[model samples]
Target chain A: MSAANPGATSPQTVHVPLGDRSYDISIGNGNLAEVGRWVTSLRKVTHVVLISDGNVAKYYQQPVEDAIAAEGIRVTSLGVPAGEQSKSVPTAQSLWEAALADRVDRKSTVVALGGGVVGDLAGFVAATMTRGLDFFQIPTSLLAQVDSSVGGKVGINLPSAKNIVGAFWQPKGVLIDTAVLKTLPRREYLSGLAEVIKYGVILDADFFAYLEANVQPMLNRDPAVLQKIIARSCELKAQVVAEDETETTGLRAILNYGHTFCHALETVSGYGEYLHGEAVSVGMLCASRLGEKLGVFDAESTQRQAKLLSALELPVATPKLSETAILSAMQRDKKVEHGKLRFIVPHAIGKVVLTPDVPSEMALAAWREGIEDESA
Target chain B: MSAANPGATSPQTVHVPLGDRSYDISIGNGNLAEVGRWVTSLRKVTHVVLISDGNVAKYYQQPVEDAIAAEGIRVTSLGVPAGEQSKSVPTAQSLWEAALADRVDRKSTVVALGGGVVGDLAGFVAATMTRGLDFFQIPTSLLAQVDSSVGGKVGINLPSAKNIVGAFWQPKGVLIDTAVLKTLPRREYLSGLAEVIKYGVILDADFFAYLEANVQPMLNRDPAVLQKIIARSCELKAQVVAEDETETTGLRAILNYGHTFCHALETVSGYGEYLHGEAVSVGMLCASRLGEKLGVFDAESTQRQAKLLSALELPVATPKLSETAILSAMQRDKKVEHGKLRFIVPHAIGKVVLTPDVPSEMALAAWREGIEDESA
Candidate 1:
């Protein structure tokens, strides 16, 4: 087992500055033990509806319940089957009823203790149950640790679309224990790196260079490297989120840089075919290539990301799906305003813009070019 | 059919002071005719997903749709069955699917044009769909016009609990037309007056006294009297809502003066046995009696409310049900914390406070007192 170095294991807190909704994201290696103290520090919680999933419960639910129970705070722990399917309406309904049955009230706090699916589902329940409850997140997966946990995006999917029904309900605090990542399977672990890379490419040039330099350490799961990447990604994402929490301003859309292509790819290829971050990996490259075609971004930067993604073992090639299907999927996104293509094409490694009205043909051409690059 | 007198017919706007969530309640005899203009005046809306129920649609959907369409705003009208049963998960799921099918998007405004049921069900949909869409309300029922339209409490019931699953989603604007109340059944209209009277007793002594003076005119549906009651009721309710929007500060609980008894009555007696306002009427009398039993309130004030409620055609008599059943039902209310009864009791007209831990026996005694008044 790769232990995060003592220095890296030291707790780091990232404060999401959302005014009244602002909360700290405590990131560390072994701070899971401090959860009870950590939560009570935020608010006077007497009852907790702790939600988790089957896979996560095997490793963590006990320590969590014990830690919270130790605080003299009553804990009602409920677990659902693990995986993407749990992010559905039925799952949400069951959780709502379960929490209510166990005596959840306006004063009760909901603590989400699992991956992105659990965070999203649990957060949605907290948002609507009793018209919002104080929510705390103990995100367990690498994908959640750096991305979903940082943002307040939580919801369930409809059969027709993923994340079709949801609310941007922020958590009171998020606790990310890096030690848990040691238990994450290889594919899921690497998929998370794609999003970690996303922050650097979209916002910070220095972070991108750091990730570029730390390939070997990152590959070996060096605790120091993992801590640095996770903390830096959260900080960058927090800055963007604080600036545009509700996405009312177009400023928040920069975070969706490649999401258009990513969503299209995920939809056209079917959801399970690509874990979200994996599609994001392939999607980012497509967005980068589209930038190159637009003449604002260079091929060197595109190649740089390609090399990094491939080194990280995330797929870089566009799948062999019909271009028409992909295009229709993009237009179908409720996020897309007026059926027009607004691509978040990166201008350089660190900058991107929400470019509007790039013809459907141009987007298609960008996809077609990626299909030709065998190594990409 | 009673039309609002021309003078009372002039639009009276009540502004709910909730910072950015603040919106005006525009009440007039015929403001429904200008719903499109009223909506556009509040926000830049291009598309409207107008939600109405079967009963409301029979009277007002087309005019509302045409008014919006005439303003060059696209309208997608949807109709649900008109009743309390429609405020359920299955109904919400169906509405979500139907709205998405009609191209509901982030920019699409959701306009709820019905009673409390449609307002809440459609509002909950707008609150969660795409993480919330701009919502407007055109409440068509007397019960909705003065009460539900002002506060942002929107949700659905779990068969186990009323409003157990919901969100505090505020509308961008709410338009209420008193003219529509002319079509409201006599029973429903009288039921709505219960809430109108509640505000006077809970917040404003002046309004309460005014209501006393205008009883005959109010019963006659004098348009001038109608305008005074509806406008004052909204303003008072808005003041309480703005002071404690999400009910976190305990100030909002004052609005629930009789809700504990009313909810338990509705739950135990089976919903629809009494319209919400009718139950509220009986519940208020019960609470006043509880107040009198506790020595803080005078019997004269209790008798005054009883007289007004009876005069207004609302039931003041407690239902013939088992005392234990009512006690258990109140304990089961999600609003009741830790099984102790927290009653919102009046010390006098125009002032109420949330009193905690009034013994279950005392509450039952209060209920028993109401049963003894033969004329109540």
Candidate 2:
């Protein structure tokens, strides 16, 4: 980790060391404007396939494209409809064809300029086009900047599954501009904070406390606080990814602390009903309660998380969805092995364990207990 | 390289040493029956997604599926039409969906069980399904056994491009049964020999001489010679791939000795106009002639290749397609850099160099000289 300046607003670099696939994530207040210099500084680029979503393209695509083009690089700006629906095979194919139509060659680089959907889809295109092209990331959304953009995991979703068809295609560089969060819708911004809190709970207790203390600044979109949390989240993730780049060792499973429950909630509730991190907020509480049920975690820790999540304005209570459906979706999750359930259950803040073969009833109870009461 | 038995009839294994990504190619007569044992010996398996083309499924798919199923492993056999046309986005998507419908999971392995088209399409399916499944190759065609199956380059084609979308996804193991070639149509079988001959031209002079001496046995598809040539070809290709796994280093370009011209001919003449290797047979001569034009190669070497290719009964004359279309196609080749024509030019039998800055006129002249004389 290195900061270009000592001040909180200055650009910071978090190096993700994965041998030959290792790269740096540059975090700053308004580094989006430095997109041109950032890309050229990493590698020579004659052509770029700049991919974004409709919502993102309006605010950021033009400036990002212009920034890169200012370096005398030809940028092919492409956009898909906003939201998760665009992260499909059809969209991936369209992007591939569009890039090809623009004469994107092996020499051309792909730069993902939107949120996770764009990052994952565009990364898949980069990974497959001409066997692969160099890729860079300019993640616009907080969720992407802190999570998807840092990891090499990129893919399109199958209709039956989310994040199912993809590859570990690492980018040459990731440029995160925290200033962009200012334009993000208030709810979406809050949804991202849930994940920011996840890093602290999973890896660093001190960082968790920092986040808890800075809720107001985070809500204010304070550049200093944003840079710190985003940088720390990326650092925590990069450490896990560097150890297990492909998740082969299961060391990476710890990052999925609440994701097993998170995915189930999102699926059973129907996607788009719960934005990912919002569901993650609800899911974390469920997992925490499950941990308490399993006797490995305490109620106080769960309450602590619930308090912080409520304060951050993210959903702390799980919605009223079918418990059976949630359980079934959890069973169908990629995490379940040999018909047995597995979850990343927390023992304490900064310490989680991958607990396997937990009884279905107990897991279901965790979800059931979190339901909000209509009478209340 | 190691042989299970010293005799030529016994299975020989060409180990592709790519560290953790390494796997072996097993070559023998009638080894297809041993497919079950071979795959299980490599890794643990519960479910297998067997992908093949319609042309091959009629003969081998049943036995292959039965063999694997006999081992108590579930086998889901999938098929596509038997031509290059099936190597497209729609075909790939259908395979993905079909595999998912059959409950394909992260633990399931994908086995490609046909020629190059099936091998490539299935391998791409394997590469992407669940972000990559363990892949095994059962190359029925000689072209696949010797070339496509050996390298990890697997992908589908876009309507506007051939193999423009793909990944370098290696198979866990490759089972090459020389007996399978017996059912191959003659023209297609001969087309495969063109690639086998290419291995000798690019890297192994002794192998080249051996191929030249064993022309009759090769043409007859003699069991021992088939195993020897296929094993030698895999060994040669594996060596190149091991040195430059992802084409990052220039070493892998040597494997594309005739492919630049081959792709151009395939394109301008329309894709189905020439089977890939038939085009290669013509392309290699053009390259040999280009080498001669540049004064780096002797005409005697060019004649030697011509004689071997002719004796192999492969096409030796370039088709009369539009020269402009051919030139433009060549320019569009992934090999061309900065608008400069480049090619793998042979300096001698078993010795080719990736020659850059090749003048367009000279490349055209090479193609022109190979044009058949209708007057005669």
Candidate 3:
């Protein structure tokens, strides 16, 4: 999976139709070069505030600032420490002050120029900076480019939980250049593949079959496969968002097929041990096992999923979390309604349902199946 | 202006019909007692995370919690230190953790029981907690009851600015009990009168006249007059909200008759020294003055506003901020567009327009009139 692969070339353009919240998710070669024109068309922006993490800022900040400035807008690039820890209230407060000091007024457009963590933090900041402002997403990581950038789920993590403080703020536009994938660590790219696999399992069985067959190519970062997967994933998410913009209906829950368990694992493991995609990889296995146990899915389905994830070199089993800890973590999941566990379990590949009440015993059984229980 | 005063005794209710975003603001005696029933009827709520600040919690927490519990719904009260300082991302993060720890699920309701600060913070948490959940308001102060509770404008403030992190999250219900106003400090009570005055000046000149003629009686805490004023203000705000739920239309801009200048002043002043209403009182004067300078408003109109504010014991002139500082602050205001200053200036009482390209000199003159040279 080398960046030199011809298919690894960047995308030309992609569209995300979310009704009034619709935005374009353009990927391809040198997409970053067109950020100024893209952002200007989306927002009546003059002053630009480019928010990036420290590491990415060191590399891409100069070019991004220059691009936006070339449009005759003053650019203030704010660099925060990169990692999960940066997505906190204190960091958001600091960014708020930095923007104030830089005089990034309401007319200024906020450009999040990093991975998922930066996108979430900066998007949340822009969403609430002045009761909301236009934000553009230049997702630098596979996870952010394919997933977070599309759904408008911007938030910061809490010490006790992940993404406990946030909002459903849509971005003005998302600029994805596969060229950035060249800079991402291998482990991070694999983690992102987990989300790509998730869209297949939850929405399109044919897509799932495509993923199963092309797992090797995807792992190798074949540009054609990668671009197709990213586009399909984003399209699926955008369709869901258009139907249920605020997540009121059941349409949006399908997008959270593995997120219920994934978020719990992310929070309990302290957020940094495993990236979001890794957690989702493990979470999907648990959800599949749960579905099988509840008679909603067959055992063959679980094996097929395990084979696909294993091929991607993604985790197919839960981590070494205790049942009680996992239960406690799951209890903190945002999906719980009236203290009853709600799981987005698959009825079949390409189809999912949000169960308001997943039987406690079945959930425990699946958790135990995926994890070793020292208690029982 | 005693509670028994003829003008302050009768109950009034204002309806904010926003389709799925609709809610009612009930102003009168025993409204608090009916909260459990009203909210219960609106949603399948079984538990409530009641959030309040120290001041209101001290006097009303136990009673409110008990009443909600009496309705057979579980209630968990979380109290924070009372003040504008509490409207921070950190405080909101803490609340999210507390809600998680208390087993607050999606079906559980969050009841905000305090003033504008508490309402804004609590409502924002509910808006994002689990990607938003049901929330109700038990506004205890004059300002919150008449203004914050009805509009569904919930959020927290950044150190650099007020209400910098928040959302336009509508509540399931807003229960305004005039009985709770009895416990508010006299200064806070007077501060609320400022917002009530804004509603009149923006939408109902007749209400403005009513306020002018009965300012003292209302400030004296006469429940009848207060009820009338609160209901009228809620009705005016509700109509605007119905017309423009997300503030995208010019209809909602009318609601910011004084807020463009008010938010700038609040942001520059650090949100500590001035109550929101106090800043708004001064801001209205600034806007009127700016209008007069631009020949949109007559000099006599500005003078009349100053005299009316003075009669109500509200600040009629801006604070001692510098012209440059105030100008910078206005640039950060949410109303600005694409690097241009936009002001919702009134041509006359009850008639406001959102003008996007106000002359810089007129704006500067307005700022100069509102500031002291040394304050810069």
Would you list the rank order by DockQ, best first? 2, 1, 3
Q: Per-residue CA lDDT of candidate 1, range A179-259, in tens?
A: 888888889999999999999999999999988888887887777778788889999999999999988887888888778
Sort all candidates by lDDT, best to worst: 2, 1, 3
Cα lDDT of model 3 by residue, A268-342, tens digit:
787578778888988888898888877889889888888888888887766676667778778767677657999
Q: For candidate 2, what is the lDDT? A: 0.89
Model 3 lDDT, residue A211, Cα? 85
Candidate maximizing lDDT: 2
Q: Compute the lDDT for candidate 3.
A: 0.80
Cα lDDT, model 3, residue A92: 86
lDDT of 2 by residue, A84-164 (tens): 888899999999999999998888999998888889989999999998999999888899989997779889888877777
lDDT (tens digit, per residue) of candidate 2 on B1-376: 1232247997889999999899988888998999898889999999999999888999999999999998999999888998989999899989999999999988899999998889899989888888889999999999999998677999999988878999999999999999999999999999999999899999999999988888878878889888888889999999999999988888999988988899999888876778888999999999999999999999999889899999988889987878899999999888888899999998888788888999999999999899889465
Better of 1 and 2 by lDDT: 2
Q: CAPRI verdict on model 3?
A: medium
CAPRI band for model 1: high
Per-residue lDDT of candidate 3, residues B288-330 (tens digit): 8888877788877777667777777777666766667778887
